[model samples]
Target: MYDSFRRDGVWPEFDRVDRQLLRAAKVDVAQVAAQIPPDLMATDGPRGVPPRGHDRMRLTVAGIACCEGGREDLDLFFHALRWMAQHEARHYPEPGKTSVKVTRAMLAKALRIPARDAVRLRRLSVLLRDERWGSVGSWRSTDDQDWSVNVGRDVRYFRRVRSTDDFIAATTAWLEPVTVATPAADLPGAASPQSPAEHGSYVDERVFDLVRQSDGARWDCTKLLALLRELDDNYRAGNAYAAHALLRAVMDHIPPLFGETTFAPVANNHPWGKTDGRYMKRLVHFRDQADDVMHRQISRTPCVLTMEDMPARAAVNRFLLGCVSKLA
Candidate 1:
């Protein structure tokens, strides 16, 4: 994001101001600044709060609704997901990073449940009421102002969901690792996930299934390749996570169960033929070698060359892009 203040010819670069003029400016500056509302200030203040202090601190239902913009359940899941994601981001100690985009299907497979159930479970736990202490440390004594208003009493709150243990378990496991371990440097892929037995289709939260999964059949490789030319997109990692809601699935529809040419390390190999359109062959070969550690050949895989078991940083964004850009 472009900072409003970071534009050209803005603030002075030097800090060599004389003390006398600085003192006079401070008082005048205070008076001038006070004319604006406290919300304009960047951080939590003597009498106000900023959005960046802690997880779930500055979040509002309005902000969540605007950003995620899905069914009540997916909206809630996204709200919770973004909150937890932002919290994890703060302790990351780096600017840009790559994190795996494990699908609900993959998660369901690990958790041993149905995919529909996995998605339902994910949608159910939209609000972590117990986890939220207070908004901005100001206690809202009234239930109307409480953040958990929609948690227990809402009717459309994934009506039949008892407890989202499976979804919670899957995500909890997926996110617990700072880095993955393997026999041969483990190339930092996704964690050992939990799953379900059956796979269920997804519901379009915004338009009552107007955008169905079956819609993917409308485009072939030629059409999808043409679509990519009309658009190019990028999403920043972890901070806002807003862009993910709009663009994540656009790519998801194009990629298969586990094949993305841009992300699966087909081009970055020794004499690997590119025109073959067989990235899955390379992935299966490398992933299989890594899984079978008899010869320690997993380390030789191009994708895991300098990373951990899954190459989280090296491949995630490309995978996301490939999902958006169908093979063409």
Candidate 2:
């Protein structure tokens, strides 16, 4: 039924929406959606099935903007969902159909809610699973206490359909290309790459907390924070040269955590897994690019490097996570 919702872009069954969880007198998602302007709602075309046989409506990108703006909980819940999706790819016990294992504790940690307030996870999950809202898969509870949810492969709904201004700004500022590779449309099951702003937000928040808690040299923590902030600023400003130089600075500064003085030895000698090692090699290559950006003399020809030369967000996060682990 949830799968049908994904395919048809309408709730397959209105009976599924828990009225008690929604805390509304009437369990009418369609009524709420009708209140929104038709321009903001999903098109009543082929995919947008009519609200028949207890089916409810799905919102458009603009509709989501209006609804989420008023509902902070909905916005933050989606943040946790995105974070869970990333974590599903990152962590061990590689996920299958049901990926994220969401216990009250885990959800609380993800949302930074106190344990006492953790009951809200149930309500949050209900709202997110609603077709008129997040439009994700159904929640399957494990052990009657924790829920396992899948991010799923069909992510058309996950794709950011935004205002023209927001789209242009995001593309110009946040699109840090890891390479001049083939477009995603040419690759099978390939989604667009994560933007720097998307992944960096988590790193920034986690590292800030780590810095506050760290017993390491205060100077080192301050320096690390400053470098990370500047790298992010350069990315947003589309200053690829400054971003490259700052990435190198980060590489040069954090080797002590891996029981090494320089990044080369850390890459070569650290007993991390092959995946992490691959990222380390990529960073090493990025370091070389940074050197060129900082020291290369003006040439007769144009410089070939652009923002496309920036390292992958995952690799950068892996590098910083290593530092974070050691600091924590």
Candidate 3:
């Protein structure tokens, strides 16, 4: 049986006994069927069994047993079956009764194996078929053709039985791991406000931290970070208009605690405090330019923000960071 399995390179179809066992264990047969390789399964019409060649089958009955129960359970199952195969006369002991009625204690004694936990042994027992004499016993005795027919029928039933809701339920249970948020301080290859290498650039890592620390009711820091990340991407892609719009969005989303309704108030309240009015004046001018472009307002000259205006962008980022600091 082991040699045939190794040579065939495809897992043999589960027999009546296997299906009954799986059902008794409350295993999701459909889920198990879904995992089976497409080519391994039998299809209808002229294409009988597909030639497997030399490719080794990946799954085994032992693997299925492991999925349903743990490794110890599989070991118990294999050991019990081996015992049954070895000691036929001890249990049956009669010619008329072809079926072996081997109890757990009898099987354990035959193999000289240690007694297993009752619950686990009960689950393993399902693998043994219960029926009239010759018709029931070890899977080894079952005809391959019979096993294939049973397997094919069950696969079809599972495919047909499963609904859209079943799929949704399975997917919901099999959820992807939640991603842990990365600290902006740990972000590499990017210039942050605290970094000395680029003092003039506007990348405030603290903004991310502030947003994360804030109570969700007060601010949607996640949305803020997403916008900031997109703004950075747009700037790198040379979409200055989009970058400016994203900056305007950032300004708009500032928490009410900052006491700033518009970009002017934040920019004017800079520590330089109107002493350097150029930053505030340039910010207002850029805001108006972005608004005009977005609203499709006609201008005498084509008023567009571009990469050349990065200095003003950096200054605005500094002012925004100042607003974020108030929340801290």
> Top TM-score: which candidate number?
2
Candidate 2 — what's its lDDT? Answer: 0.58
- Candidate 2 has what TM-score? 0.48
Give lDDT tens digits, candidate 2, residues 1-328. 2333333334335444434325656556545544646655543333434343344544533344455232454455556645554454444444454343445566668778765554355545544454332223666666424665555422222333234334334334433455566676798987434334322332344444455457464335878888888887777666767788888898999888877888898887876588988998888887788889998999898877776678887788877777777776
Clash-forming residue pairs, model 3:
none
Span of ten consecutive residues with least summed lDDT in model 3: 148-157
Clashes of each: 25, 0, 0
- Model 3 spans with C-alpha error above 4 angstroms: 1-202, 215-218, 269-278, 297-305, 310-313
lDDT (0 to 1) per candidate: 0.31, 0.58, 0.47
Q: What is the Å distance of residue 161 in model 1 from its true position?
A: 9.2
Give per-model TM-scores.
Answer: 0.21, 0.48, 0.34
lDDT of 1 by residue, 44-113 (tens): 2344432222212222223223333324543444444433333332233233433222233433344344
Candidate 2 vs candidate 3, lDDT winner: 2
Deviation in angstroms for 282 in model 1? 11
lDDT of 2 at 289: 86
